[model samples]
Target chain A: MGREDKAMVKKAEAATGADNRPFLFRRHDAGTIREAYRKMLLIRAFEEGAENAYMRGLVHGTMHLSIGQEASAVGVGLALRDDDQITSTHRGHGHSIAKGAEVKRMFAEFFGKETGYCRGRGGSMHIADVSKGNLGANGIVGGGIPIAVGAALSARRLGNGKVVVCFFGDGANNEGAFHEALNMAAIWKLPVVFVCENNGYGMSTSQARATASATIAERAGAYAMPGRTIDGNDLSAVAEATEDAVSRARNGEGPSLIELKTYRWRGHSKSDRNRYRTKEEIDHWMTENDPVKRIEADLVAFGILDEAGLDAVRASVAEEIEAGIAFAKESPSPDPADLERFVYTEGA
Target chain B: MDQPVRELSYAEAIREAMAIALERDERVVVMGEDIGVYGGAFQVTGDLIERFGPDRIIDTPISELGGAGIAVGAAVTGLRPIFEFQFSDFATLAMEQIVNQAAKMRFMLGGSVSVPVVMRFPAGSGTGAAAQHSQSLEAWFGHVPGLKVVQPTTPEDAKGLLLAALEDPDPVMIFEHKLLYKTRGPVPEGAYTTPIGKAEIRRKGRDVTVVATGVMVSRALEAANELAAEGIEVEVIDLRTVRPIDTPAIVESVIRTHRLCIVHEAVKTLGIGAEISARIAESEAFDYLDAPIVRLGGAETPIPYNPDLEKAAVPQVPGIVAALRDLATGRR
Candidate 1:
């Protein structure tokens, strides 16, 4: 590891304290931390399995994998209740898993099977489990922002006390929908948290090249909302920031923006060639700043789990991914005769 | 004994329908720009804010795209939002939400959710609002699948259709003509639903079938009255719904009259008239045609600002009379 990388890791370790108990332990139990670790592993394993399936010609079309940004999804998800809703983006596999979507059904969706979340109608870009409070992932940039605000509006008017989290990439910050949605949520004091997962680059273009503001979180000031930027690789930092934001929203204090600074180890999509970034930069993040590795180290250092316990977690995740793929493979495709079944509400 | 007759302007009927929906369903909300104390651009939502209060009758900022999307999101999450576009032409700004999100939400989510949202568009020309404000874009929404598009000609249907749209589980787009807001007609009190996708035969005859929508329905009726004195009988059918069009009614009318003339305020090139004509040509009504189907619609240009030019642009009573006369007399 480079000198700068070693120093950064040391600083992160110092934040956990001299005894090595994770700072997150103050707020979360060992069981909760372990579950978070398991979810992070599941997200990584799910993406890898999906990537392998794509390579083997088992999956059609392209997918935007959140291979390195698992912590942001899990952290925010950890702060939300099962009934609290979220609107995800194109690169939303991690968010879906974090929000309690079944890996089997997600795989079934990827395989275009009828057992999929969207019953094969919506593939990678549109997976949703509304019963679980996931509105659905959107293909359009900043598309889900306004939808999330609307969900908050529903929560307020219906007196449901349910908060909504809107997840988007740094690219979406430039979209007018984002600005407008934030403003409306603030004016109405709707319960919603705007989570911007700034993973350095939007496709090939860097955030510095695309955005006018210094930071995506800073843009939240224009909407008169609280904003924060944190180390997304650090699970404790991400969870804490999201918890604060989610609490603010639940208290009817309006929306808050939490920008998670992270990076993606893989190309933007399956089609990207990684021409815009350097091999050294990608290698740096992969080896030194991997979210899964960071959490596993913390789990070990904090005595939350031993090496054997970590191995068991990994083994279970692998089995789950294998079974998910198998289930999707065995599932049936939708019938051609019922092509127009879901176009409109039947009998309406 | 007959029910007590009550007359109401098109605007009052729409307001009453919204009031009924608000009273019947706690989830119903009416939102738009200047819809509160400002009373909307055309006064269609007049005094609704006082009746329903600001929470239910919201005055959204001039953010058509965001407002429309918020309504869609609200609808998906259990609130029935009735969004009003200040002008029909402004829908272009919010097409992404209406077409991509609202229309496709249920289908994309595999029927797990339904967007029970209604969008009201104050449309048509003749108000001197110029090209931008005056447009009959019902055909635009009609072309989209998963959307229910309706046009109400009279005060009664305006109230009935709005109420029916609220009950529908899918998204419905209602296009209200700007000029017809002041036009009064008998409307019943209380809640009642006019069935969507059904055509009302406004006037019946056996010569030529004049199928019209929106303001064109009134002009067609006027033409039918004028042509009756000249021994030319014209049957006028008001096409209330544009998307799941009342095909059976049009086919039956055409089979009886043996002649068809479709009229609309939208451009004739690819308007609702084209769709109706195509449906008749493809259906069993084709064989019953005694003459070639005629379509009298707006000219191929934006609505002009001048009163004379604007009147000439769309199908007026004179234009309808001329087209109906030509078709019924075997001249065309």
Candidate 2:
């Protein structure tokens, strides 16, 4: 191997640390890796912007920010086809943006503007874009699991070779809908991948206290499906694992459960007081296991691009997000005359 | 000229509706527990698996939450899924998906997607299924904004309404009375849709107007016959859909008869009768009523296992006859 390639391997090892999880390039090429990095950066910048908006009272309601779980969010996008379907959780801005939702419309939703995906009726929690294959981002925890199963069933019934990725949090594992959905998906051999973003804490309760199993993926055996847990902060690790699951689903091997072991850099929402975990613990994860920084380090170590290229990606993402916010600000609010228009398919 | 219609049981009519839907649209599928090989708890989906195979006639696990959620998901994603609850009472288990997710998705999502799902519940008290399996929960579903609540009282309506509900672009709750499943009626062959929000007048009398739903419509017809012999003519109107109720029909009937009696198998308090009564009282029907509006509904208690007690709990032929007789005679 060349000196730069050897140096990249060493840097990947250093970044991965003692865990030594293999960084196999399954579906990600250099172009896709660069695109994945750009998407992850966009998600991070978008979340930071959402938080700033929430703080400034520009965002009307609270939102769950996947600030540190960018790799897990963007990795699935990079691994799957553009038309692959997904159902997201309340903490779904990162997933939505990574899955190719228009950032301006998402910002408009937060601003309660008429140009939003739901035309401002569904605020932060219920945003969705059906055309992009995002069934919706659910407000209810584990709500999208069954919906993803149904979407998979639809894809199969329609004879369209589409796979569904169901994104959920650690807390949703205990919900009845989760177990039911998994069992149904398993039995039907539905083309769905259950991607659990186990970010250590489900709101206030730590996973250690809330769950009996050491890892969420261990429960997959009960349903007779293949499952694994990997470092969600490592973009390559997430991509490798998700690529396998997506392939299995597309090949009609039924569903697979993948638990991305990651942490949330921000509080669950704006109201969270950070009383659940200590500042030291939060600081440790933020500095040591930041997903965005981990990928940046990998790109730098490979000598693929220097500081100038990385800075250019960051600057462009920031500019795009800022422009989205401006567009949202300029969008008009919904008219009062159309207040009761969308309650049903036809008027009730 | 009258069209020729075939006589079929209410259950057969429902099966025929599903079979026709499956044949016409490849997007349509039937899903529920024990609905495939077991042929459903009431045999409503018999021989369907043999014809359509297991893919189209899906038998779900005994998980209402999971099955209903899957149906909701499938519906929004462009599949016309007909989900049956073996018993209407089991709907309590699937309320989260039905009420929160399926019903609210369109409104909450600002009309971006439509959940064209049809959930069938074999409702009302008749069999020895007793309390757990014999509750009339149509009022509960009707109270929700996004749901279209309908109860088919005849075989013709059972077929026509089911087919029409499948055509709607929203979630529809179809409550088929368990007792009426065996009752044979003239059902039109081929594709047809019964208008959802219209009422049918089975018998037109000049003395008292009787508005009934589900099996009560049959009971009211029997009561009208008994009252006709006693010189008290009773008009019987079958209210097909409860949510988008035929209020104009009720008002018109009350104006002609000058008396009103609302009958249902659901509990008297806050039941569907209350809504109809309130609508009439708020409209022009109140000025035309010669007597007070009478609500002859089920007693406020759990449905008993004993046949006699179960029969007494709801408004029967005897109860409907008595209520209409009293209203016509001014004996209130």
Candidate 3:
């Protein structure tokens, strides 16, 4: 509304160019770096448990596991302030955990427990804890992208000084809403970050088969915003890229599109046969680009802790998971009469 | 208060209503394509952007998906965002946002939220806008579960219906006919709210009940006047709200009159008349019926580019009168 902000809005559109350049990373504290690692491990463990529970019919819906992709969720989430919001994908348990949503309640939701994030209303793909600023994962492919842009626009309108990060897949980039939302964000210079998790495939369709372009991040130039492709498997690289983008957004520099180069190690969903991907494809990421292992290696290289100390954190996290399971087991299913609740976030 | 009962244009009535709403509630915000300084393509929101400023009167980008979604978001987040679609046809772009997200969010979230959003769509045919811009798709939202549909006939009803829509806790789709903007009548001087999902009998008679929606109400009344000259008395009902439809009113009128004719600008198949006729046939009103319901609606075709072709596509006053003549004389 101010003259200064209006001038910057004009300059923001003119800032975008045809240049394809690399964005470098900055160093972070050892504690912050390790926290990202433990969080990824926790996400992996929780989802692994969910996959097993779902197979046993303990959980009802199809589970979209973030088994292979964690660093992107953790790195970007760590860069966001407490008030900053994020919209995630079906493969979003990691995003939720990374954004500081309660793990016990998330597990409870999967188990149809009364103590779940949505009180058992939303299962695996719809875990939303708005109080923690996680806008919840969407069922549709590109559904939540526009919502994130809208949220950022609201922040900008009220001058709330809060940024919104929207997380979607490479498949979503093909959606009209994606382009429209990104263009609106760019035109308004709203504080929004568009994160494209290019995990090789969109459901059963490979990105190569579905997309005309070679790289998804390159398409961001059409929307006239800064775009980057990072080593999504490398925790340090993702963390650094996220910091730069988050800082730019906070400074009223509009939105940034980041393509995190990673792959889904498990099947796309619980029922996925994963025949579209070769075994070699899965093995290479498992052996070389494992995020937890990368961080564990750094933890030892810095002489901060030995294997025993790290083992204790894992054990403690596992204990918390067991208690969550117990809580989920005790949690009751929602009554049929309570069906008409919480559709809107207001006075429902 | 005794105000002059002069005829007013539909667009001017909408503008006057918006002025009153802005005067009534500070929480109300108007957002849509060209609704800002552009004053809207139809000029329904004339000069509102200048008077209310950007915060209250927003000029959103040409992204209907984002515009409607944000309006829904703002509505749920404690702001009453009255969205305007430049043309009713553009609603197809925001169907998922309106039907799936805004409409069902209340029920899906277990009644924990209230989508107090009013979507003002410049609907129906008259501008020769061709297929893309000229459409009357009210039946689409009316069929949805968690939404309310309103279509006003007179200027006073337009004011009343919009005020009521702004106050509802659910999403209300207000279908404004493109040709009805200039039709004027007695509008109250001060603040008031019309009861939604309620019908008003514009005229009382005995021979037949002619229930119409939106612009067809005026057309039906005209047909009734000509029919009165032919010694066939007809009652006209204006169904203000399409969803949670004023069925009891229509059934009551039909039971007394023993004949019914439903009229609308939309196509005959799956139109509001189809549903209302089915309701009449299934309900207790079936026992009192003297004739099978006659439904006069638009022909099945895209609104053509040629003005003549376009005019032939939808219902006209002559068409309404012909339908009424057939119903009174036992002709098909």
Candidate 4:
């Protein structure tokens, strides 16, 4: 191995926490880790800006933020092929950004402008980039799971060898679509990876109150597929598990169920009064298990980035997020005459 | 020298349409419970599995919501998936995928993509399958905006409409009458499409127009034949597609006949017939009507398991004849 690789491995090994689990940040080189860190921070900043926009009455309807679940989103995107497809849930901004959605267009969508990804029709919950293989963010709970299976079926039938990653929540695991999709993927041996981001709450209902299973991953056994639960806050762990699952799907082993144990830092939506959970609990996850800070510590321990470098990264990302909002503010609104469009294919 | 036409059953015609579509396009696939080896609940997909193999003719587990969602997903992404429900009544289990996802995906996404999905439901009451196995819910699908609901009565229209539905860019629901599957008619030899959104005049007369759908089309024609013997001419209009309810054709017919009688196997309250009656009354045909528009529909009750009750629940030839005679004779 190269000297830099050896040094990173040594530093990653030495960067283990008091819990004694080997920090495997060495899975990616320092450069890639740095890039992943930037992407996660971009998601965090963009979500914060969106929340502000909603507060300022600039956004329509409501927006579901993934402020605390950045690692799970970015890590899954890192494991996927550039041309690979994904079906996301309502809480899907991070997935869209990580899958390469243009922040300006996303902001335009939230602003309900014509230049948005869906031409302003689908706001926060329904934003999609077919070109990037982000099928769309579904409003219905567990709605996108079967869609991912169908996309996987398309890949298998078309001989594209592309894997489809399906992102849902712990509550979605209880949905019948989840069970049916997993069974179909298992029997058909379709290349799909089902990622359940267990954010510990299903719209204010605690996971304990809603779910009967100890862990969502255990339910994969019922479908006869491999399942795993990982520390979603740890970027290295999330990436490693997702890479393993993606490779398994590409190798024609059917689907793997992955449960990312994460937490959402914000309320479910703009209307949430935060009555479901305690402030102490949110602070505990935000401080001890923050994905961004964990990666910062690893970068600092490995000597790849210093406090100044981290500050620069945050500043650049913040500038980019502000520029995206500005672009969306200047974009045009859709013509009212076009309101009746898309009911059916125009020419077909 | 001339070619001779051969008679084919409605089920056989539908199977032929699917077979032709599978042969024509590699992207076309059919899925449902027991659709492969068991040839579907009504044997409409017989021999398709052997002909096209399991990959094209998929047999799914009994999960309506999942199967429908998968088909919706597949349709949006470059595949013409024809999903079959074993019975129409079970569609209630899949309303979320059909009504919410498939119906709204294109509009909600601002026309970014088209979902070319076809769903086949074995509808209507005739078999001894009782209430759960029987229903005529075409109106339910017709009420949805993005969905196109078609009910093909004859073998010819069965093959034609199924093929046409496959060609449609949006989701199309095909309500194949369970009782009509065995009925035989002269179907064309090759691929053809009965145009959607157009009504066909089954039998022409000038006194009154009998607008009907699915099994009621044949019942209306039979009623027309009986009324013709009674020296009363009844125009029989077969409404092949219900959503794009051929109002112009119905209006023109009502204007010519000066009377209207609508029939459907679904219940009378707010059924497809009600829409047809409303359209006729709201149009210029209302001024020309010599009698009040009549709606002959199924009784307001679940189809019972008893053969006699089941037969009495929906409109029959006798009922259509009686209704049309009353309208023709101006007896309200």
The best candidate by TM-score is: 1
- Alpha-carbon deviation at B87 in model 1, angstroms: 0.6
**lDDT by residue (tens digit), candidate 3, A1-348:** 233453454466458742211121125555765676678888888988887777788777688888888888887887888888888888899999999977788898888777888677767777876767777687777777777876776676667788888999988988877877888788878788889999989888999899998888888788888899988977767777788888899999889989999888898876788788888888999998887786666566454457997897799788878887778888888887866555433332
Alpha-carbon error at A205 in model 4, in Å? 1.5
Q: Write the per-residue lDDT of candidate 4 for residues B199-236, one digit (tens) a residue.
A: 99999999999889998888888889999999999999
Who wins the DockQ comparison?
1
Error of 3 at A151 (Å): 1.0
For residue B151, model 2's alpha carbon misses the true position, in angstroms, by 0.5
Interface RMSD to the true structure, each candidate: 0.6, 1.3, 3.2, 1.0
lDDT tens per residue, model 2, A1-348? 334665766677788774332353434456767778888889888888988988888877788888889999888887778788899999998888888998899999989999988899998898898888888889898888888999999989998899999999999999999999999999999999999999988889999999999999999998999989988988888888898899999999999999999989889998999998999998999998888787777777665556898999989999999999999999999999998777776543
DockQ of every model listed? 0.85, 0.75, 0.27, 0.75
Q: Write the per-residue lDDT of candidate 1 for residues A1-348, one digit (tens) a residue.
A: 333554565577688764333457668889989999999999999999999999999989999999999999999988999999999999999999999999999999999989999999999999999999999999888899999999999999999999999999999998888888888888888999999999999889999999988899999899899999999988988998989989888888889999999999899999899999999999999998999988887777666888999999999999999999999999999999989988899877
* TM-score of only chain B in every candidate structure: 0.98, 0.98, 0.96, 0.98
Q: Which pairs of residues have clashing backbones in candidate 2? A: none
lDDT by residue for model 3 over B127-231, one digit each (tens)? 878889888999999989788899998888888788888877889999999878877677776656778889999999898999999888988899899899999
Q: Is 1 or 4 the stronger prediction by DockQ?
A: 1
Cα lDDT of model 1 by residue, B226-269, tens digit: 99999999999999999899999999999999999999999999
Candidate 2 per-residue C-alpha lDDT over B186-231 given as tens digits, one digit per residue, 9 for 90 to 100 = 9988889887888999999999998999999989999999999999
Worst 10 residues of 3 chain A by lDDT: A17-26
Docking quality level of the chain pair in candidate 4: medium
